[model samples]
Target: MSTQTPTVRGDAYLIVDDHALIREGIVRVFSDTRPQARLFEACNLQQAIQTLQGEHGPSIDTVLLDLNLPDSRGLETLQRIKAVAPDIVVGVVSGTDDDHLAMQCLQQGAAAFVPKHGELDQFVQGISAMACGGIYFPRELLWQVTGRLSAADAPPMVPGVASVRLTQRQGEVLRLLLKGLSNQVISNELGISPETVKLHVSALLRAHKVSSRVHLILACASPHAA
Candidate 1:
């Protein structure tokens, strides 16, 4: 059976990578399949931020971000980008084969992870997957990062006092909170008021027995907690 190609909108894409060839290759692929996909190029994080913040007002539907850049390193780059544009769908493109880093990127709101060493087919597939509302993680790396599990596998939540338990709404807030989304972003994402997001955040902190959002994220990502 033939696979369906994603129809990316004409004016929504940003590519942030230091290497010229990689950027060119990505542009070529998109140009071939998604001729309507408008492309913006950035050699570094600062430039990427400028492109996003430029009078267009977050028109970017997807971003292909390189983890290693002259100005930023490791996960810090991802964090900075997300901080600037929490609503933009980000995909981490990296040279390293670090599965753990890829998993962390996913946890931090990246829509996909693509390795530089992977085949062009895989990269194209990843982009298509992201464009179609699916996350793309390398098949080989998934088990190493998320750990092996069967269909029946389920992790237990921590037992605690009833007051400390999170309500369904509060739990949704906590999920976004763990992604380091701000109150305004969370409010918009959840379709709730900023004040309500703030209240839910406060409630989440109290329930998780944590004093700060950083602590809450650490708690939520902890293996023991899940």
Candidate 2:
């Protein structure tokens, strides 16, 4: 990623990649996928900061950021962006093909993460998922990452939160929730009914003392939870 970026501006959807061609391609895809979205462009971390913190006041809904920016690298780029505007959603688009990087990005507050070499459909899916308050990791990458985790590696109980007493099914539901799975998606994954998934979600909300799935994600991601 280049350390120098042209002084550019954008709104609605922000595309932050060092290469102009990559940003142009993103704008082209979003033109069809989200026609209503106003596209913004930034070449590096510095320009991205200016665009995001400009007069619009977080007017941009989602940021598609390249991890290896001129001034930042990997998860550090995400941290800097969030620092500029904490509430703005961000999706990582990088050349790297590491599933663990995707997981780490998600846990660290990215709304989504996808490889730049992935098909255009994956990019579309990632943006769409984030727009709906869901997190996106390429399904294959997600499966591979989760598959590598054993029971011994599972998060331990939180001292004050009774998230520990969760039943096997409840635990299953929480794992999917942390993965940013929707209720219907969770049902499909677990071979359970949608209503059952809803019940489990409600139970998890109560157990975690968090009212929303997003909050549950934070609780799970935080050091205090483990």
Candidate 3:
């Protein structure tokens, strides 16, 4: 297994992929963006786990996981890591162009789903967003999911928020929220006043019983969500 040992220190991002080139490229991008950031490398799931269990383990907050590792594949690998360290922020790095699979990974608790072949900015954005407790739904996947959910004919709400049902307008507002749009932007898009948009958002938050917009987004974007 190939590995690069960095003595610089800051946030810890463990790149778990079987390919040395893939892991190295990601490390380069990270080093350029945050020079002081310490990056760890693992060629497979087992090595990845060992890296996490080592001395600097607790300091590690972000994990960049490749779905097609030698020891595992698909969302199962993500599930295993989360099972071991629920606190770790895992952002999936997939070569697959499957939106459904990417969405599934997000639902399975990945903080972000980055297409391996996508722009370098997107990969950085995914890791950066996840590091800050934000979900980085890839632009391609986001556009698709937003278009799909904009129809407002979604499935039933999941168990925890089963009682919360968003009206059509509320659903639109929710979709905008997931897109990270500001109230003014949403209002402009919906051709409604900002106050009206705020009203709907407040109602949605109350119905979902979330104290903040972030929680609301997480609840809705979850796999078991409405």
Candidate 4:
């Protein structure tokens, strides 16, 4: 039930975890990176929902949530956060490192899925991606999923294909994506609107025959991919 009121002008972050240590660690890292950023803390799903519904809710730009809260578990935690603050970026920071769970989080609208075992730098990267309206998965998870898909001997259209066609702008978008830029960042980089960037991203995914941005990046990383 404790919170740190953020300033009116900078980005606000909500850290939803029952563990005091985890919350403090995230707060410390985020403060190091974004000194002026606002932070809020919650112990469980109910507290989190309450904070999101409170006066500071609209100011929250991102939410770093732990999946295994005392009152909520698994994807339901993410779904509830999205239900209350659909526009706010939500990133999962779970102790579990399973790729299946990571994929599920992505499918369920998480902007990032980071395992608790990862280093702080990697965690920060995930947060950064989510903050900018982009999706991020751990590199190990990405490689694992890519390998699994590769082992399936996927159809030629699914990532390992030669020369998936792309418009000049799509190519620009792809290049930025490879660099791990989010839609908002890509839009700023390409001088296009975020909605336009989303369209190009969707086109890239379609061209690669993959469903998510993480998969699109994986496809682009393949040797046979363009």
Instruction: Give the per-residue lDDT digits (tens) of candidate 1, residues 1-226.
Output: 0122333333467889999998888887777757766677899988888877775434577889998899998899999999998877788988865767766887787767878785778777666654444456665554432232211233322223333554567766755554444677678888999999889888777777877654454455456543
Give per-model TM-scores.
0.59, 0.64, 0.64, 0.68
Tens-place lDDT digits, model 4, residues 46-93:
999988888778778788999999999989999999999887777898
Assess candidate 1 and give its lDDT: 0.68
The alpha-carbon RMSD values of the candidates against the true structure, listed in the order shown, are 9.8, 7.0, 6.8, 6.0
TM-score of 3: 0.64
- Alpha-carbon deviation at 157 in model 2, angstroms: 15
Candidate 3 worst ten-residue window by lDDT: 1-10
Clashes of 1: 0
CA deviation > 4 Å runs, candidate 4? 1-10, 131-134, 144-164, 167-179, 183-226
Query: For model 1, where is the 10-residue window of minimal lDDT?
Result: 149-158
Prediction 2 TM-score vs. true: 0.64
Winner of 1 and 3 under lDDT: 3
Task: Please list all clashing residue pairs in model 3, or write none if there are none.
Answer: none
Cα lDDT of all candidates, in order? 0.68, 0.71, 0.71, 0.73
| Candidate 3 Cα outliers beyond 4 Å, as residue runs | 1-10, 118-121, 124-133, 148-207, 210-226
